[model samples]
Target chain A: MNNVVLKCQSLKKTYKKKNRKLVILKDINYEFKSGHVYAIVGKSGAGKTTLINILGLLKKQDSGKIFILNNDVSKINENKASEIRNKNIGFVFQSFYLDPLLTTEENIKLPMLLNNSLDKIKINERVKKLLKEVELEDRETHFPKELSGGEQQRVAIARALANNPDIILADEPTGSLDPENEENILNILKSLAKKGKCIIIVTHSKTVREYADIVLELKKGILEEVSRD
Target chain B: MKNYLILILKRIIRDFKSRLVILLIALILLLGTIVSINEKTTEEMLSKETYSKYHNRLYQLVKKESYETKKKDIKGIPHIITILHEYNIASEYLSSEEFKTPNTDHTIQAYTADNLSLPKIKYGTNFPDKQGFYMVCPINMYPNSNLSSNNINFKITNKDRIDMQQYLNKTIQFQFENVNNMNIKKESIDIKIVGLYEVNKHSLEDNTCYINESAKKYIYDTLNNDLPSYIEKSNPEAAVIIIDDIKNLEEVESELSKIGYRLDPYTIIDPNFLIETKKINKTYSLILSIICVFLLFLILFKDTKNTLKYNKLLKYLGAKDNHLYLTNLIHNILIILLAFILSLILSFIYRGLLNIIIYFRPFLFSKNEIIFSITYLFKIFITIFISTIIISILNNVYIKYKLNKN
Candidate 1:
């Protein structure tokens, strides 16, 4: 009975397209617990990114409330939300979004820079540790452009775990990666989930869904758990 | 604060190339605005009453025909330091004109100055503290321009250069002549050469001399004492008006003009007229400052897409809008401060270059005084600072609002 790390109740979001109300998410209730990898599978334009963005606090939900560690965060101001995100949640995206100017080591140290609790020595130590976790110790000085697709993705994962957040939300993490790199990234996410971190990934790949502990299907703005055949 | 500074440095390093272009334009605009304001402030300084206390400039006044300007005529003019009468007397031995013509080149021009016009003494002493008929001549005896090899038979070796120093304590006879209606009267007086002056390095070699005001008056009076009753005693050939302030030149000239006196065409005019008057061109300064701010805004706006993309990325990394706002502010301020320092250095370099060019080739460029006031720099800095703050805050807030809307 892993503790539930994140929960959302009756979530709804809508947008106005051509004078018509288009619903992106409708009355969604979900609980994400620790030590599980949840794959949110949806068709293109099915609001998968929207759901993940709201859960990551990168975007605001138009209606309904969210809870992290049993504390309500829906009414938090952006500053507090940012603090919570920095401390409690991590995000990875399809584009990798590594600061082009930063080296692999520096990119891994980015989120830790926001954590005031970590001194310079601790930050450096954590960066080295994370680089080792991703097996990128040798490539620490290489810029994102210099790294392969898989190596860059590993650096992105290392960056997401920089502050040791309990929840990791990834959007199309393997969308641009090859088959071998995709397998490698999924195995890393699986290892993170085994370490008692809640990993939620939004994707369209069936292999990722099969690899996930629980698969959720998002269709027409509704989310439903699908049975593993 | 350290963390914030590090973040700012990171952001600046990443965007350094794109920001370099904006920095250059900002520097140019800043210098342009500074020049405009310097012009306006110079004009304002000219009109200020306190300026007279620290300034003194020279101008010459020549008496017109049928006009007798006495000391009483110029007494009422404000800012007049002193009116010294200038006299041209014939010196037989001291004048380099002797090489050219025994009669014509002997005319030596003399002036009466209290102390401001005294030349730097290179040898011997300056005029006595209790001055009475004292004179100071040039160290180098420059021949008259007409004393070329073709016209003059005078040839002197370096031995002649040694003889000029011997005249430091010697007395030379100066002839004071008055010619009236074909009547000629001549009086000779002995004046001692007390000091030798070091002439300017850039000036052509010339034998010019300085005499105290009392000596000039004594010679003028000796010639005027024998004049007929129809001629006035206090009338001078010309008067050199020493003004206490350059700023008061225009006003003093106007006052002198009102009293039937005109400045000599060769008189040195105040340099402020080069920038024009405040009423005519001060508005240009304000316009330039406005344009500078607007141009900065335009550059920032043109880069908005990339800036917004970076900001969004930082936001996704859990940065608050406030942090992003501060980062933008610090970035702009850093660029502006760099431009400020660079513009200051460039302006001083420009001033030095202008003076150098004007010094060597006087005909090619007019001499100008380019003064940079700290008050004006501070004022412009504040203007840019306020504008930068407002623009940075507005830009960040707008981006935040726009992102929220999306």
Candidate 2:
């Protein structure tokens, strides 16, 4: 039997605008196991982002049970939610949201800095290893502005791995990159998945879905599992 | 705890670097506020000290009639020793012939024979030893009505002596009589200027001439000795009593009142000085505290709100809320502390500037030895610290509510 890393049941998200309730997600049930890259594919406004936000604990689901490693997340408070996000989950954004003021190395070291549990030497060692792993060792001292789209995204990837999280959540990680940079990022994501990290990528690209171990489509507040070669 | 502190510090450094201009502006504002507050406080303290010293040295006393029953004996009552003694006293009369220039307008204070001892002189002389000797003038007499220095000419029996040397060997005419019945022409006599003496500066009467003991005796003896034999005897108009200590003045006054003597209005010279000083100090402190609190609250609230908004973004970037809060607090506290330190330095600089001004113009201060006293600095620190802490906590509460709502 496969080890379950994350499970979501009856997750619902409703948005209220001008006193009108618009249901973005309804009764969404999903299960994520270890060592598999899951891709949630959908067009814009299809609630892919909403689902990703809920899974990352950035937003609360209206009515749901979310269990991470057999711990129910809905019962936890904000601080515990943050703790779970900090220790077990990593996020990569479509905008390559690197802290613009920090150098690439500092950006990569941000998670450890925030956690503050790791000493400077351990942080430095982890950052160095991640920088080498992303093939951006020489670009560590450069800021986000100085780096290209692919290089910045690579720095973002290195930052996500800084805390050695068990789950990686990427929201359209390659949506801003060029064709060549997209392939590079996809290959990196694939490699990360091979290292036993449960990588979940939210994307509409067929290329990302091809690289993912499982592809799920969100259509009209419903989740449908699709097979990907 | 160590880890948390380190995390907070790192985040503070990052945010500071990110918003360098805002941080710099905050620093300048903080420094300016601190410096202004500290300088103002120091100036107030100096003024209080100046006023206190002068008030203490002056030893002014005022007499006010509390009841009609105590009115008759007011002047003779030694209220400084006991409240009851006020009944034996009479009123003090101060009048000026001309109100303008010192030379034209001469001030004359006429009191009973007993009231003469109230003014303790420091230098020059009081009345002469022999009968009908010389008139003693006030020292520190300036052209202005206000007494500035002890410099005055002596006029003995309508003969003006510009300098004291000329009057040393001369004999002068003197007269002493009741204010109501002054038969000065009939009883006037001549006495040699035996010696000179000085009076205390704190006395109520500035310019005074002492009547010789023998001279006063002669006036009383001549008046009383002839009164019963040839004319009607006159009652003693008033008497003056000087107490050893001013603290028991009220008790002495009350005691005198119990003896069927009407008590007069009296003044306590000692505590009045302290009371005036306390009033001035309280006003100064209150004004400064209000200003400091106003400025500090404005700065702290604005800065904290902006910081909290930034911290929310940090929280979204995987930082814990606690981490963000701590970073915001540390950064703000550090800026405030820096501003306080700079302000303290500025206060000393202000003191130095005041000293320089006083040095060039020595008359600005009554005393030539004006030193920068650190006694008020500790007061400033305590005031600023308390004000800043209160403002910071208020700001924190406001920011927390704002961010948490979002």
lDDT of each: 0.71, 0.60
Q: What's the TM-score of every candidate structure?
A: 0.73, 0.55
- Over 4 Å off, model 2: A100-106, A135-149, A227-229, B1-310, B313-323, B345-406
Candidate 1 local lDDT, B266-306, one digit each (tens) = 23335557446544444645665687688778866777776
- Give me candidate 2's TM-score against the actual structure: 0.55
For residues B284-356, could you state the per-residue lDDT of candidate 2 as single tens digits? 6556656656666666665664566556545655677666656656655555555455555654555456555
**Number of the top candidate by DockQ?**
1
Of the candidates shown, which would achieve the greatest TM-score relative to the real structure?
A: 1
* Candidate 2, TM-score of its B chain: 0.39
> After TM-score superposition, what is the CA distance of residue B229 in candidate 2 from its true location, in Å?
35
